[model samples]
Target: MTDQFLHDLLGRMTTDEKVAQLMQLATPFFKGASNSGEITGPMVNMNVTDETVENTGSVLGAWGAKEIKAIQERHLQENRLGIPLLMMADVIHGYRTIFPVPLAIGSSWDLELAEKSAQIAAKEAAVSGIHVTFAPMVDLVRDPRWGRVMESTGEDPYLNGAFARVQVEGFQGDDLKNNTDTLASCVKHFAAYGAAEGGRDYNTVNMSERDLREYYLPAYKAALEAGSEMVMTAFNTVDGIPATGNKTLMRDLLREEWGFDGVLISDWGAVKELIPHGVAANEKEAAEKAIKAGLDIEMMTTTYASHLKELIEEEKVDASLLDEAVLRVLELKQKLGLFENPYRGADEEREKEVIRCDEHRQTAQDLAAKSAVLLKNDNVLPLKKEQKIALIGPFAEGNDILGPWSFLGSTDDAITVKAGIEQKLNKEVIAAKGSDIETGEDDDLQKAIKLAGEAEVVVLALGEASEMSGEAGSRTNIQLPAPQLKLVEEIVKIGKPTVAVLFNGRPLDLHGVIDKTDAVLEAWFPGTEGGAAIADLLYGEVNPSGKLTMSFPDNVGQVPVYYNHFNTGRPKGAPDAQIRYVSQYLDSPNAPMFPFGYGLSYTTYAYDQFSLSRETLKKGETLTAQVNVSNTGKVAGEEIVQLYIQDKVGEIVRPLKELKGFEKIHLEPGETKTVQFTITEEQLRYHHADLSYTSDPGEFVVFVGPNSAEVEAQSFELE
Candidate 1:
C-alpha cells in the first residue's frame, strides 16, 4: 500500500480511535467484555472503557488460533473502521520447539544457524496467530550479573550487530506480505538497557554519548538497517531520562540521525512508569511526553488511551502527531496484508503440525550441540556407551532447561539428560539425585556418591535453575550452590572419572566444579533438545565446538571481565607478575575463568602464524591476512579462527584487541585449510570524543589465533 492510502485511512479516524491506535492492551482486556457494555476487572483498573477497547488497534501476549480468531472476529464486528488487531507476543528463542538461549547461539558463531533459529521461531509463531515477535534483543552485555544477558548474543558490538542483521532478516524474510510463515520483527530494549546499575533489571543507565554510540548503539542500528519494523523502548533510562519519554533518544537520535521511520513501542507500561522515574507527575503528562518523544505505541498502559484525547484537546500536543502515529500503525498492518486478510496466517491445523514438529526438534538439537562450550577437559570425555554410568544432580532428570523468555515453550516436553542418554544406548544408565539446585540432605549426597563409586564413570549435571538468569534474575554471587559443590566434593572422592555438565543462563564462577571435575561442559540451559545435545557430546556422536561470547569472571569481584578491554598504564604484565606497585589484585587474578572465543574440542588445531598481504594499507585499498590451520589431533573437528585488531594509538583509548572477523571451518586429521580475512577502512572506525566515527592514521596490530589470550600478533600501518 502507498503512503496516501495510509493517510486516507488515518484521515477517517476520530480522535478517540486515533488515540486508541497508540494504546496496546493485553488479550484479557478484549476477552473480559461485560454484557452491559462496560469495562470491568483489569481493563477497569486500566482506566479504559468498553468504547476504548473497541477502538484499540493491537493485542499483546495473545495465543492460540481459536482464542485469537474469536477476539479478532468480535473486535472487527464492533469496531467502526473495521481495523484489524495486530497480535504480538514474546517469541524470543523459539515458540514451542525451544532452542538454546541467545547467548548459547552466540557461542556457536554460526550466522546460518542463528538465522535458521529465528526463521523457525517466526514460522511457529505465525501459525499460532502471532503477527509480530518482540525479539532479537541485541544489547551488548559485558556483565554476566545482568540476567538478561541470556537473551543477548554476547559482549562484542561487531558480533552482536552481525547476529542482529541475520536474525532480523530471518524474522521478516524477503516477502512478508505473502509469506505466511514470517513475522514482523521488533528489535527491543533500545538505547542501553544492558548497562543497568548494579546489574539489576530495569535500573538506571548512565553513559556518555560517545560510549553509547561506540559500543551500545551499533546492534540496534544494524537491526533497523536489516528491516526490523518496530522498536521497543527499554525499561531503563538513557542519560538520566526514561527512554519512553526522552526526546533526544527517541526523536533526535533514533529518528533524525539514524533515519528510523518505523513504529516505536514501549516495553510494557514504560510510559506510565515514567511517573515513578520522577519524570512525570501522572499518566497524562507521561502520555503527552511519550508522543512528543516520537513513541508510536504505548504498551499495556492507560496513558495513551486515557489521556491522549485530553492532551490533544487542550493543545498540549499537536493533533498531527497523533495522526502520524496512527498512520504508521496502519501502514504496518497494510504491509502485513492484515487489511485484506485479518487472520493473516492463523491456522489451527498447521499450528499443530509446525509448533513442535520433529524437523524443528532435530534442528534445535543440532544447534544445541553446536552451542555447548567445553570449558575443561582432561581426556575424560566421549564416554563409552556400554560403560556403567551414574547420572547425578538437580538436572539429571529435571526438564527446566528452557531459559527465560521461552513463554510458549513447554517444560514437560523438554528432554532430560538421563532420558537423552538412555535413548541412545541399549542399556539403561543408573541415576541418582545428589542435590537440588540450592539444597539437599547429606543422605542424598551419600547415596549419590555410592552410586558414582559403583559406576565406571560419573556425569554430574549441575548449575542454576531456569529462573536464576533472565530479566529480573541478576545475582551478586555467581558460583554454584553449596549443596551442588558438596555433591561434587563427595563424588570426586570416589575415584571415578567425573564430567560435569553445567546448565545455566549466564557465565558463572566455576572454581568449585572446574577444579574437582575431570571435564566440564558449559551446557547453558540448552532448550528442548538440551539433554540430547549433551548426551551426543558425551558419547562422541558430536564434537563440542562452542566458544564463550561473554567472559566468565574468575570470581564475582571481577564482575564485568571481557576480552575487548582497554590497557591500563599500570597494566599487570603477566598472570603472576611480581610488580607489586602495578594494577595487581591482592586476592584474585585479573583474567577471566574463560576468555571470549575460548573453547576446547576433542581434537586440536595448529596455526601457522598469520602473514599480512601488505605492510601498509592505503585508504581505498583492502589488506588481506591469511593463515594455514591444520587439524593436529586424530579426529576431525570444527574451529572458529578469530581475527582481532589493535589500534596502538587513537584519539581516544581503544580495546586491547577487538574482534573483527572469524571463520568456522571443519578439518579432518592432518587436513590443512587456509583461512583469509580482509580489513577495510570502515572496520577501523571508532567514535571520537565528539562522537565522530573515523580512524586515525597510525600504527595497528593484527592478532590471529584460537582465542583472545592465546594469540600471535603482527604489526601493520594505515597510510
Candidate 2:
C-alpha cells in the first residue's frame, strides 16, 4: 500500500501484465471467461487471452455487491500476483433512489443540496461495490441541441465551477481512506466536450485559446483543485486533434502545467477512436499516441491490450510511459484500500438497508421540490385541495421520470403523477393516458377532454420522453411532440384552469404549452420521488425556489441565445445604431425566451436602495455592494439574489453582464433584508489576449436583481 511497495509491484510486472493494467473491459468479459482462459460470448471476436482477462486492472459497468464480490474473488485467485480489479460504474445522478438531472440541480442553485445529493449517490454506489464513479460532468453548456446538456449544470463557467467544487467535496469526503460511504469521483470529458458544433454530440470543437480558457476549462480546473482522483478524456477534438491523443492538451496543459497527477482516463473507446478521427492510421499508432499523450486507462477498447506491447517493442513508445501509467493505476487501487480489503464497502445485507432508505428518498424529494422551477404561473396555481382534479397526458401514469444516465434506477420503483396525487389527497383523481410520448388516437383526445369536464382544474403532465434528451437525445425541434400539443389544444378549448407540468431533460421551446396552459412548471426529469415532489408543489406544501441555469430559446432558430452575450458593433436597438441593418433577427428577438436566473414563486420580492461602499476601489482593497430586498407578497419564500458585473470599457469587447456571485436567502411575508456582496480585484480578472489573468483599470458596473433580465445597477471605478 505504500509508495515503495507500489513501485516494487510495478517493477515486477511483465510487458503483457503492464499492458493489461491499462485495459478496461465490460463486466461480462470477466464473468463469461472460462477457467482455461478462453474468451467467450460477445467479446470472442476480440481474441483476448485468459491471462489478460485475469490480469485486467479494472472492470467497467460492474454493479451489485454479490456480482462484484464474485468477480474480485476469481480475479485474485487466478492472477499471478493477485491485483484486485477496480470496479467502476456510471453513477451519474443516482444508484437506486434517483434525483433530478444535473441541469435541475443547477436550477436549485443550492450548493448544500447539490453536495448532499452527490454524497447520497456515492453512498448508494459504494455500498453496491463500486470504487469509482464517472460523475460531476461539469462541461459548461450553452447550446440546448447537445443531448448531454442534461448532464452539465448550465452555461456559465462560474456557476458550473462552484458546483464542481462542492460535488467533489461530497463525493470524496473529508477522509476517503476511512469513509466507506464515499467514492473516488472521476470528473469527466477533460477538455471542452460540451462545445460540440451545432450542439451535436461527438462533433469537432473549435475555439480560440482565449475563448477556450475564458468560457470553458474553468470547471475542470476547479474540480482538480477540489481533489478529484480521476479525469476522463473527451470524445471530441480540442483545437484540431482528438482529446484522447492530443499531447498538448493532455500532457502540456493538464499533466504538466496544472500538475494533475490523478489518473487520466479515456471516455468509452476514445483512445481507439483516434483512428476514426484521422489522427492515427492503425491500432498500434492509436495506443502509442494515447499513452504518450498521458492517457492512463482506455475504456472499452483493445488498442492498449492488443498493440501496446508491439509499440513498446518497436521502440515507437518508451517503456517508462507504461510504468508511469501502471503506477498511477496501482496507486489508485491502494488509495481505495483495495489491497487491504478488496470488498471495502460491499455488504449484501447493508446494501438493502442503505440503497433507497427513507432518509435518502426524503432528500431526493426535497431536492426535486427545490429544483422544480416556476417558469409561468397565473393566479390558478397552488391548487386548492378540495377542487376536483383531472391529470392527463403521457406522463400521467408513465414512470420514465428518472431521466437518462440513470443506468441503475428502476422504472417499476418510480412513482407516477397519478400515484403521487392520489397518495397526497388519499383519494383517486380522474386520470387519463391522453397520449404516448409521441402520438395518440382520436379517441384519446376526446376521452381527455371529457375528463377535463369532470374536474374544476386540469393538470397536464407532458414533455419529451426520457429518450428525447440525454446522450444521443438531440433534436432539431425542441417543442413538445405534436401529439401532446394537439392534446393540449383540445383540453384548452374545454375552458378549465390548466397547468402544464413539464418533465423534460433540456430547456424546451414550449410553444404549445406556454401559451395555452394558464400555469407552467419546469419539473425537469424529477427522479424516483418525482411525482410526490410535484404533488407537494401543486398543493402549496413547498414553494418553488429553483431558477434557470440554462436559457430557454423562443425557438430553435435562436439556439445559443444567453444573457451574457457581447454587445456587437452593430448592436440591435442601441441608441447610436441604425434600424434594419443591425444584428437583430427579423422574426425573433435576440434575448432568450427565459433568461438565466429567471424563476417565479408563489410570493414576490422587490429590490431597492442599492448602494456601493465607495466610488473608487484601490488594489489590495475590497468594496461592498448592498441592496435592500423586501418580500412584497403574502407567503414566505426563498429568493436567489444574483450579482452581475460588467467592465464598462476593457482592452477587448466585454459581455453585457457576467454573474460573479449569488446568494439564496429566505424571507417572511413583509420582511426586509440587506444583502451584501464583497467585490475584490480578483473577481474582475479575466484572460486577456496574451492569456494574462489580470483586471484592467477602468470603470465597472455592478447589478443586483432577482434575475438576469431585470436589475438595479450602480457604477464604480477600479483605480
Candidate 3:
C-alpha cells in the first residue's frame, strides 16, 4: 500500500474506529462471545468491554500460528474497516531457541553474534505471527539494582548504540516489507527508563538534559536511525513529566528533532499510569495528553479505548492528531504486508520447522559459550576429564537457566549442567543440590560437603534464581543469597579444588565467592544451551572471551559504581598514601570489584609498543592509534583489546576515560597482532555545560588495554 492508500483508508475510518486503532489489548479479550471474557487483576476496573475488544487495532502477548491466525481472522471479521490487527510480543532474546540475556550478550562484545541472535528471534517469532518484538532494549544501565538492567546492553552509550543499530538491522533485515523471516523492531523505553531513581524499577528519573543526552538517549536515537518501525514510551517520568505524556521529549525531541515518524506506543499500562504519576486526573485527561504528546498507541490499557473518541469529539485533542496516529498504525500494517494478508507470516508448519531447529540451537550454543565471562582463575579451569568431579548446586541439574523475558522458551527443552557434563566425560560424577537458590537446610549442606570430600575437585554451581533478576527484581543486597553463601562456606572448608560457576542476570558483588573458589565463571542466564556451553569451557573445548559490560561493585553500598565516572576535586590518593581528607572510602577501596571490560581467558595476551600517527590532531582530522598485542601465554585465546580516551581539560569535567573502540581478536600461541584504532574528531565531542556538543582544543590521553582498570597510556594534542 502506498501513502495515498493509507490516507484513503484513514479517511474512511470513523472516530470510534480510529480510536480503536490506538488501543492494544491481550489475547484473552478476543476469546469469542461464548467464552464470556472476564477481566481480572489490573483490568477489572479498566472498563474494557467485548465491543471495545472487537474494535481494538492490535493484539499483544499472543502467539503461535494457529492462535494468531484465529485472532486475526476473528478481529478482521469484527473490525469496521477490516484493518488487520497488529500482533506483538516480547521476543527479547530468542523465541524457542533461547540465547543469553541481553546483559550476557553485551559481554560477548560481538555485534555479529548479537545481530544473529536477534535475527534468529525474528525468524522464530515471524513464523508465529508476531509482527513486532519489544526488544533491542537499548537502555544504558550503570546500576545493577535496577532489575531490568538485564534487559539492556551495559553502561556505555557508544557500545549500547552500536549494539542497538545491529540488533535492529537483524530484526527488521534490509527489507522488512518483503522478508518473511523478519519481525519489525520496537526499540523500547524511549527515554532513560533504566535510570530509575535509586535504581528502582518504574521509579522517577530526574536528570539534566545534558546527562540524558550524554549518557542515556544515544541508544534509542541509534535504533531509530537504523529504521526501527516503532518506539515504546518508558514507564518512568523524565524530569517531572511521565514519558508517555512528556510532550517535550516525545514531540520536540523524538518527532520534531529526531525525525522518528514511526508509531510510538506506551509501555504496558503507562498511559493510564499518568494518573498515578500525578500528571493527569483521569483516563480522559491521560488519553488527551498522550495523543497530543505524539504517542500513537496505548498498550495494555483502556485509557485510549475509553476516552479517546470523546476527547477527539470535544476537540480536546485535534482530530488531525488522531488521524495522524491512525495513519502511522496503518502505514506499519501496510509495511508489514498485513494489508495484503491478515495472517502475514502465521504458518503452523513453518513455526514447527523453524522453532528450536538444530541450526538455531547451534547458534544459541555458540553465543552462550561466547557470553560466559571468566571472572577469576587459578589453574583450576579446563578441568581434566579423568578427574573425579562433583557438580553441586541447585542449578547443577536445574533447567531454569533461561533468564526473564524469554517468554517463548521452554525450560523442559533446556540442557542442564549435569546433562552437558555427562555427555563430555565418561567418568561417574557426583552431583548434589548443595543448597536451594535462597534456602538450604543442614542436610543439604551435609550432602554437598560429603560429595565434595569424595571428589578430586568441586564445581560449585551458584547464583540467583532466574526470578531474582528481571523486571521488578531489584535487590538491595547484590550478593549471593545467604543460604547459598553458607553452603559455599561449608564446601570450601572441605579444602578440595573448587570452581564456582555462577548463573545470574545482573552483575554481583562476588568478594566472598571469588576468595574461596579457585576459578569463577559468570555464566549469566545462558539460555537453552547454557549448560552445554559451560561444559565446553570447563573441558577446554572452548576458550572463554566474554568481558564485563557492567562493573561489579565491591559491596552493595557502592551501588552506582562505573568506570567512566568523572574525577572529583579531591581524587583518591596513591594506594600506599595515608588516607586523610582525600576522596576515599573509609572501609572499602574506591575501585569496583570487577571493572568494566574485565575478563580472563585460559591464556593471556600482552600489550606493548603503543604509538600515535600524529602528536597533534586538527579539526576534521583522524588520528591512528596503534598498539602491538601478542599472545604471550602457552595456549590459544581471544582478547578484547579496548581503546579508551580522556580529555585532559574541558569546560565541563569529563570522565577519567571513555571507551571509544575495541576489537575482539583470536590468536594462536606466540602470535602477534597489531591492533589499530582510527579516532576521529567526532569521538572527542561531548555535551558542554550549555548542552552544546563540541570538542575543546586541548591535550588528550589515549589508553589501550585488556580492561578499563589496567591500561598503557599515551598523550596527544587536539588543535
TM-score for candidate 1, please give it.
0.98
- TM-score for each prediction? 0.98, 0.98, 0.98
Per-residue CA lDDT of model 3 for 594-656, tens digit only, reads 999999999988898999999999987899999999998888989999999999899989999
Clashes of each: 0, 0, 0
Question: Compared with the true structure, what per-residue lDDT tens digits does model 2 show for residues 1-719?
Answer: 58999889888889999999988988877853233233466456776777888889998888888888888988889889888899988988899999999999999999999999999999999998999999889998989989899999999999999999999999889877678898998998878998998999999999998888888999999999999999999999998999999999999999999999989999988887899899999988999999999999999889989888998889989999999999999998998888899888998999999999999999999999999999999898899899999999999999999999897999898888998899999998888978889978988888898999998999999988888899978788888999999999999999999999999999999888899899999999999999999999999899898999999999899988888889988989889888898998999988888999999999999999999999999889999999998999999999999999999898878889999999999999999999999999999988898899889998999999999999999999999
RMSD of 2: 1.6
| Full-model lDDT for every candidate | 0.91, 0.91, 0.90
Models, CA RMSD each: 2.0, 1.6, 1.5
Off by more than 4 A, model 1: 32-44, 574-578
Segments of candidate 2 deviating more than 4 angstroms: 32-44
Stretch of 10 with least lDDT, candidate 2:
31-40
